[model samples]
Structures are given as structure tokens and as C-alpha cells.
Target: MATTTSSYTRTGVLEVYAKQQWHKVLATLEEDHLSLCLDESYEVPPITNNGTLSDSEPSDIPESIANTKRVVRVVKQDNNGLGISIKGGKENKMPILISKIFKGMAADTTEQLYVGDAILSVNGEDLRDATHDEAVRALKRAGKVVDLE
Candidate 1:
């Protein structure tokens, strides 16, 4: 594939998303009130039958990476909270990227969010152009019923 460079940002896209949907946020109980995490899970293998599949292996990249964007509703279980850690904020000239997903937590249980995933928004607040502190605030502020894009 070919590549091109330009001044492009995901913020604009997320803004449009916010307008299109209604989302509320949940607050996190962190010492710094920052450095909050989201939720995620491992990729499930496709079920196949005997002699019905090809011999070639799948792509190295996770199938989830192919989509430009998507939204998922992540409801945290009581007290467990959204199970995810993130990195790369606007100050870093990057999106809110998921760094880790705790097993058996809200994110992992949903099986939607994933490590290395770029979260454009949380509960409809755009993080595409937000700083690390701001991203943390938005994520922490999300309600029990969270929305991630």
C-alpha cells in the first residue's frame, strides 16, 4: 500500500461522532485522578470445521485494525471499573491508545476494546486531540455505562 503525509487529526472525526450519539461518563477513583485505564480482551479464534479451511495462516495484524473506527458500549461491573491502561495523548501528537487490558475486568469481559487500540472518545468526549491529563479525565469521568470509539 502507498502512504502519504499531511496534517490530519482524529479529533474532527470524533467531534462528529459525539454529535451523532448520546453518551454519559463515569468517574474514576484514582490518587492523581489521571492515569486511568479502559477495558479489552483477546481476539477470539474463528470456528472452523474439518477440511473446510485453507492452510495459510492469518495476517500478523489483528483483524480489528482494518476498520478505521467503531464505537462500543462498555459497562463496568460493580467496583471493578473499566479494565484498561492507555498511552499517547495529544501532547504526544498521538491518539488515546490502549496499552493494557486487565483480565476479568470490564474491558476484557466485553471483548471489544483491545490493547494497542486508539480510542477516539469515551462516553462521547473526544480524545483524538486531548492531552494525557485530559484523556485521563475524560476516561475517568465516564459513567458506569461507557462508550468507546
Candidate 2:
């Protein structure tokens, strides 16, 4: 495989990683300069026999990074606060996700969070298989800093 030089900024790399789509990001920085070397032939493994991953293996569907992690902080005020409502997935087995965001709230103001983004984790705790009340409890325990990833 031939390696090629590509101009990639740190900010851009962070943005892509933050979206949690790219499986790997390799960067070379020298003399206050940086570059990215991409290996285009890398392949993700197929789904396992049990329909569940053994570890942190990437999903079988490569087009979309469904398991990507993103963090949104809902800042709190003395009275006014983070304005968002959540609901459990339609199927009991599915994870909880954002149902709605009220107008003029911290989440609405940021515009980074969305209605359908799945709540993967809260404050570094995994909520992937949590029940409706369990997920809500985690969020409520977060207090002023609501870290939704």
C-alpha cells in the first residue's frame, strides 16, 4: 500500500473524531506542523454470530457510525435550566433517546444536540441497555452538568 501526504488540520481531525465515525485517526506533527496519513484499505469486521459484538468492534454497517459517541453539556442556571425531554425507545430492548427539546433552553440554544440522538452515556456511565427509569435516574443525578454522550 502506498502512503500519501494530506493536509489535515488539528481542528478538523478533532471534529471527525468527536463525531466518533472514524475508526482510527493517525497524525504526524513536526515543527508546529501536522499532517494525516490515511490507510484507505482498512476493513471493519462483519457482525458476529450472536448478533452482538464481543468488545469494541466497529459495527458491520460501515456507511453510518451508529455507535459513535458525542458529548453535549446542558448548562444550568439558578432557576432556568436545560430544556429537554427524553423517552425510552419504542422497543423495550432499545436504548433511550432524546424525544424533544423545548424552545429557549440550553440545549436549544446550543443546537448541537438533536431530538433523535441516542443517549449512549451520561457522565461517563454507559446507558446502552438501561431501562426508562434507570436512564432518567442517571440524568437526574448529573445535577448542573449534564454530559450526554
Candidate 3:
């Protein structure tokens, strides 16, 4: 018996390759007990002649670099006085309150410190001048005990 070889076409090759690649990926994930995580906000619709439209694009860039930075002011006040407001009078303020009350003979030593203390500085740099995320990252870098007083 003789066998003849026929030339293969490339039109559907990419699709076939993609399917095979997907299968390989799934197999690898199964073997490793890994899964892909997708955001709940993502929505997919059937493809049309005009192509699918994405509500947003996923980028490989870090959020710290991609997102706009804002300043978060820490204020000192009582539970009744605590209120958070967006800068430029945007909206109502959300207050940060502490529920645990400190009780001990050493209360005198801690009396100088109070619960509504906002982080005013990190590494001696005033947070009032820094952006919200920037101040947080700076505090993390400083390795100091962040507290209110």
C-alpha cells in the first residue's frame, strides 16, 4: 500500500492552534490546582461583525502608577465630632471612631494620647502635603507604629 501526502492549508491553522493552546493551558492548570480569577464587574457578550466592545481595558501596569493619587486628611476629634469629607467640599465626611476604651491606673501615661489621632507625619514628613496613597506607602516604608493621638 502507498500513501500520498496532501499539502495542509493555513486558513484554520490559527484557530486550531489556539484551541490546542487553550487545552494545554487548562491541563496545566488542572495539574497544578490553579485557576484564573476574574473580576465580577466583567461582562462578555457574543461577538458581532463589528467586533466585541470592552467596557474597560485591562492593563499590566501597577495601580499605584496608573491611578490618580488623592490626599486623605487625618483629623483629631471625638466620636461625635469625627467626620470625613472629600476635599473641595465634595460630600459628607466619614468619621473614624474607636470603640475600645483604655482603662488602667497607667491611664495618666496614656491620657496624652487619644483615639481620633490622624497620621500627621511619616518619617518626619507631614502627611498634609502628601497624597493619600503616597502617605500610606511612605508610612509602610518608615516601619513606624502608626497610631492616633
Candidate 4:
């Protein structure tokens, strides 16, 4: 017996590829709980007369990401507690950063700590030069309060 195979045209192949890419984008958005509104037109907020930003035009405004320090007080629970992961060890020069924040945990509940935020200091001790293990140890040593910068 011989089996027959079906082949797709170039247009069909392109459509399949496009659908796959679109699905990937949608999956990413769903993971982040984000929604897209590419078809919708929203009103832009008028530039305020703040001294920091130029009231003249949007071009004059400086684009920058601000570094913020957040202090989170997490009470130890009987079972699952503060859920967070840190990265940056001896080999890497980057400071210890929050790698993940598990849902329903104290960190997630507090909403202060976020992924990618550097864990600068723990209880006044700087962790910039500390290895990944040291950083984890510092966080473990910190009782009830986690100070991050």
C-alpha cells in the first residue's frame, strides 16, 4: 500500500507561519497578563507644566528608566512563604536581582518586589560584591523584613 501526502502552497505556508507567530505573541501577552489594543486609538495625556519635563513638545522629554528602592515586610508563614529567586554569582559581575516572584506568595502579595529589581542591600549589608550564595544567605538571614534597592 502507498500513502498519499498533502503539500501546501507558498501562500498557505506563509499564513501558517504568520498564525504561529501571532499565537506566540498572544501566549507571551497572556503570560504577562497584558492586553493589546493596536486597533484602538486612545487619547494622549497633555504635557503638564512640570519643571522636570519640557511643556513644549514630546521630543524634549527625556526617556529613562528610574531605579527605585522598595522595602517589603513579609511575615513568615507556617507553610509556603516569601517566594522569590535571585541570580548573580561569582562568575558574573551583575548585582543580585530578583529573578522570579511566585504567585500567591508574600513577595507577590506585597507587590513591591519585582523581577529584575536588584537586591542591593539586606539589613544594611550590601550584596553587590557578594556571590549568589552569599546573597541568598543574606536574604535568609534577614528576619521578616527584606530591604531591596
Candidate 5:
């Protein structure tokens, strides 16, 4: 006996199929709970100093250095996205800064999160040196919940 096979020729059919498969797998993985993990990676410019080191110096040195800092932000969807600031840095630790740009809902808190808030981890993964873009991509790929405050 011979068996016949069916094939799809529509555009993005493969993508759709893959998405369905992923959803099915995710569903099975989360059968015990409704928790979802979300993370985002973004680029943070290095600190710059333009002031002269000394007044006696004839020329002023550009204090700004070009270095890349990777920031990964994680948020739990089911928990109302309540957490500390997502911005990666030690200088600014306000939640308002993070909430200002997050595409999703923002947390309600009296204290604000700033641009320099240090990011410690995402979904239990340490993001000490991860780039902002890398973190964002990883979070999106994980398909977790996220909220900005």
C-alpha cells in the first residue's frame, strides 16, 4: 500500500506551523501553572565625562568613553509586573524610568525607577554583562510575562 502526503504552499505557512508547534510545546510545559517569563535586552551608552581633569591642562580631554553595556529586564506577567527598576545601572534606581519606555503596562508605586537601576537577573538567569538588545530578544523568545514600573 502507498500513502499520500499533503504539503502547504502558502506564504508564511512554515512560520505559522512553527508558531503553532511552539505554542503547543509551551502549553505542555506550563500545564501545571499559568506563569510566563518575559525579558528584554537593550543598549546602554557608557558614562561620559567632559570636564577637564585639571585646570592647568592645556587641552580638555573628552571624558566620554565608548563602551557597550548589555541590559536584560525580566518581569512576571501574572504578578501585576511589580518589581524594582528594569534599567541597568547603579546610578539611577527608579522604577519610573523603566516604566516610561516599556511597551506594556506600568507598575503602580510611589517610588520611581530610573535609567540607572541595576538589573540583577531575568528568570533566574544572571545578566551581568548582557547587552540591552540581547536581553530583550532573550526575554521575547522566552515568551514570559513582563510589566514596566
Candidate 6:
């Protein structure tokens, strides 16, 4: 119900939100089948170095949720896809961030992946620095089943 904002640049987000350009942001998210929730409270992970999303350090996030890793396996077919939309990539100077998990789909069925969650890899390929197109290729090339983090 709440938005997750970890991999996006702080300054860029502020500019968009400041101007209330919600449509523009949404349009961007929908690009090339890539993938919000409206909640009042959220946390934005600070930029660490080299323009990459920072690892969750002990002081950066709550110990209870920090460094909590997850694996989401979704079955895909010609008739069905991952059912999860994403945003962010190296090209955007951000991590692969989950923006939406469609209901009654593979992703929603897992009950694990959620908006604001960052996708660190796909099928063991590290996406920490993958460009937006690279990330899209990784997902599309993953075949019928994909394991994501």
C-alpha cells in the first residue's frame, strides 16, 4: 500500500514529486513493459558511491529488515508473463526496482516481491550495475522460468 523508494536518485525523485508530475513518472515506469503504491511513509536509501544504490548498512536501515534477501521464482508462458513491472536501472542511475506486482499473477502469488523492492539479480546474473536495456534483456532472455531477487 505504501511506495518503496530505495534505488532511485534522491534529487531526481524530489524534482518529480515537487512538480507533482505523477503522470510523467508513471509513463516512464510503463516504458517497454517495465513497471506504485501511495502510502504516506517511506524510506529512500542514500546514494553511497559511484552512483550506485548503497548496500543496506547497519546504520542505514533497521536491523530487522536490513540485508533481508529474497528469491522469487515465477513461471512464464506465451500466455502469461512474470506479472511484475519494474523501474530503475544503471542507465537511470538506479537499481532494478519493482514498481508493481499485478494481482492473480505469478509475482503476486509468491507473496514476497513488492513495490519498492530492488531486483539485485536475475537467474544469478548480477544486475547491480546493469543498464536499463540490459536488465530488460536479462528478464526477457530468462526463458519460461526466472529466479529473481
lDDT leader:
6
lDDT of 6 by residue, 69-126 (tens): 8787887746787887677787776677776677788777776666666789999999
Candidate 4: clashing pairs of residues: none
Off by over 4 Å in 3: 1-113, 144-149
| Per-residue alpha-carbon lDDT of candidate 5 for residues 106-134, written as tens digits (9 for 90 to 100) | 32232233333334455555555566654
- Which runs in model 4 stand beyond 4 Å of their true positions? 1-65
Give TM per candidate.
0.57, 0.51, 0.23, 0.51, 0.27, 0.56
Which candidate, 1 or 2, has the higher lDDT?
A: 1
lDDT digits (tens) for residues 1-149 of candidate 4: 01112342111100012421211111112332534333224333332332243222212112242354555566645556468877665557566766567778877786566665667788788887899988888878777665555
By TM-score, the best candidate is 1
Candidate number with the higher TM-score (2 or 5):
2
Give RMSD (Å) of candidate 4 vs. truth: 17.0
**Runs of candidate 5 exceeding 4 Å displacement:** 1-115, 146-149
Evaluate residue 127 in candidate 1 and report its C-alpha lDDT on the 0 to 100 scale: 83
RMSD of every prediction? 17.3, 15.7, 21.7, 17.0, 21.6, 13.5
Q: Which stretches of candidate 2 lie over 4 Å from their true place?
A: 1-67, 89-91
TM-score of 3: 0.23
lDDT of 1: 0.61
lDDT of 2 by residue, 1-149 (tens): 11234464232211123443333444455558766645546443432323553232222433254455668787865666577667664256555767567778877776677655678888888888788888878877777877888
Give stretches of model 1 more than 4 Å off: 1-61
* lDDT (tens digit, per residue) of candidate 1 on 35-74: 2122224222332223353222222335655445888898
lDDT of 4: 0.53
Q: In angstroms, give how far residue 19 of model 1 lies from its true place.
A: 28
